[model samples]
Target: MSHANAALTPRHRLRIARLIVDEGWTVVAAAHMFNVSWPTANRWAQRYAAMGVAGMDDRSSRPHRSPNKTDQQLVRKIVHLRWKKRLGPVAIGGKLGLSASTVHAVLVRCRLNKLHHVDVRTGEVIRRYEHATPGAMIHVDVKKLGKIPDGGGSRYVGRQQGNLNIRATAGRPKNNKRGRVAGITFVHTVIDDHSRIAYAEVHANETADTAVGVLRRAVSWFAARGVTVERVLSDNGPAYVSHLWRDACNELGIKPKRTRPYRPQTNGKIERFHRTLADGWAFGKFYNTDSARNNALPGWLHEYNHHRPHTAIGNRPPMSRLTNVPGQYN
Candidate 1:
């Protein structure tokens, strides 16, 4: 197929080739008319003579056959062994009397290279889900981050300084400790189930009162943008089960739902958002103090909601999926 920016479309190639073969136009003249090279014109003409117009289309760059490629039966065995035992390439190779590199190549070709794709027990795929509409459900989760040390920690300085910073603050009270520094910051995130639009805040603790407060702010934030929170989903954390949290949900007319006791995937949307938050903001950069990291959350949240493209939603910003209701940051 012709690529978007290709020098010549299939039609152009066919036209040039036809002019040379049927109309007896010289290859050089045809090449000049099409603004292509002599070899290009010659190849197209030969292809057309051999296979007609169809030959003007692009062909696979890959060879017709790879003689050195591992046999299909052998490849299947490697895949079967991988799925059955969840073994690494080296282990599978050893069992099958093949080189580790060869087993890896087979696994790569079969798209069975990633451990996450295979279930350890059943070897079945782990599928994902998304709600149908914005605000149909909101995934709420909390991520605890160790605060950076004063004047920056190991990431900014050296490991020795980081340890010294931690030891220096060991005498401080529990509430005062910063992440890695001495205490921790609990990041409460509420992400729209469909659009993946997220609202996040860093708090001192993940107490029931803190969760309730965060939920109130998140609901108000969504309400301002015209998305009513129908339901809220979260893990079965103590804060989530508290009467304060439930009362807060009732006040907003949002039903509270919890994931199964040990299954966090039921609230996977916010869980995934937490990972993004960590990579893009929390630990994304070095901060001199806990306050600096906390300060970065607002800006990063804005970027995540209004600028960062979400892969699950067709690579458009989460705000784009908000439909008629544009986000506040938008």
Candidate 2:
């Protein structure tokens, strides 16, 4: 196949081949006309002779057969072991006397890389789920991040310096056991089910009141941009089940929903957002102080909503999918 920026297309190849074969032009003349090598022109001419115009079309460069490829018999055995035993790659490799990577590669080629892709009992494909409307449902969740030391965290300062910062902030206890605990920050996140536009805030705790407050602000933010929160989905955390959270949702006329017990994937959107949040913001840079990290959230949030492209949204920012409101946070 031609490269993304290839100078000649299949049509050009066909034309060059016809010039050499039908017009009786020499290979050198055809190559000179197309600004390509004589061998390139000759190959096309040979293809035309063997299969006519269709043969001149671009074809994959991959070899038709790989002699060194794993035998199909061995691949079938690997698949059977995965289905029968549900063993992980390393364990399967150990049983078969193959390297873990080799087993994994075999599984990938056979479409068994993830257990979820196959039914444990029947080995059938599991259907995936998706919502169709922006803000028809919203995912709400909390991710707990360890607070940075007062001055800076170990990420910025050396481990020893970080220990000193912790000691300075917590002070040595009277019993001389250890410094006070470094508090945790709960990041409350809400994302649209369809567009995946997300809102997040760092708070001292993930109490019911804090969750309700964050939801309120998130609703307002989405409302300004034309999305009305119809349903709020979360895990069965105490904060989500609390009467305070329910009352707040009732006031906003939004339904509150929870994921099945121990099934975090029911609220998978926010969970995935947490991963992106960690990679892109929370641990993406070194900050001298926690306040610096906190201050950076708004800019990152703006970028997430208005600038950063999302793969699921066809590489456009989530704001592009929003309707009935201004396209940006502004």
Candidate 3:
């Protein structure tokens, strides 16, 4: 493409060049007529004389050669570290005794500047795909968050006080000799692949029974929004692979699918939703009590579904995908 400051487009260049070469117009006259420099007009005429019409097009600004560029062997090493080791520029620089900026420039040239651009499973560029319609397939996952003590966690109160609350309110009594385990809330989520609409429930455990119950509610919730789930996708977690989960899917008349072992990317939608859940709701606000935070989830989820703009779906709220629903609009 021509730069903004260029005097003429390829069409105009061809016109001016033909005027000078074929029409026998002087370079200075063609330059004056086209409101360009004499040298620019003369250059185009010369290129046309040698290379024909192709010479009138834009040319790459990159230099033909760079003597100081990294050697091919070193370039191969840099690329190897990026794909094999998944190291960042700074780490690669440190390991190879090169400057981080140098390493970064190389990464940019190789189109490996962002780690997400590479697929860990195939060592190739990441190719993203989505199912055709809402509920054609839904991804399921669980996010385990540390439950704030009754008073609060360190984010709001002081860290020392937070530790005190944890010890005082431990699932095990303080008098027990065994080490205490603080509370953990498992947030089970189901997200539609095509629309990015999601539903979730916070539970005390990630047991198969809890997972199955959450799936049932999620299916009903999506049905209310005018989407009937056809299939469910989840990781091969114990809860997801259990007999209870299988029977639940059978009763719901939905097919169940699992990602390949150790490959979470096969179920990337719900994995991404868990990150969004943590950032936008779970830790977005400081809560004085766990109960208060739990109560806030439904409100946040409503906003996410009805109001919040989601980039993956053109910055409209997830409810936009359910336009056929009676109460879809504000």
TM-score of each: 0.67, 0.67, 0.76
Residue lDDT tens for model 1, 157-253: 7887886776665443454544345766788889998889898888889999989989899888888998888999999889999999888888889
User: Best to worst by lDDT, what's the order?
Assistant: 3, 1, 2
Q: Which candidate number would show the highest lDDT if scored against the true structure? A: 3
Those runs of model 1 whose alpha carbons end farther than 4 Å from true positions after fitting are 1-81, 89-116, 119-122, 167-171, 174-181, 326-330
Q: Top model by TM-score, which number? A: 3
The candidate 3 region of ten consecutive residues with least summed lDDT is 172-181
In the range 265-330, model 3's lDDT, one tens digit per residue, is 788878888888888898898887777889999999888888999998899998888887765443
User: Pairs clashing in candidate 3?
Assistant: none
Overlapping backbone residue pairs in candidate 1 total 8
**Inter-residue clash pairs, candidate 1:** 146-179, 147-178, 147-179, 177-182, 177-183, 178-182, 178-183, 179-183
Q: Tally clashes: model 2.
A: 0
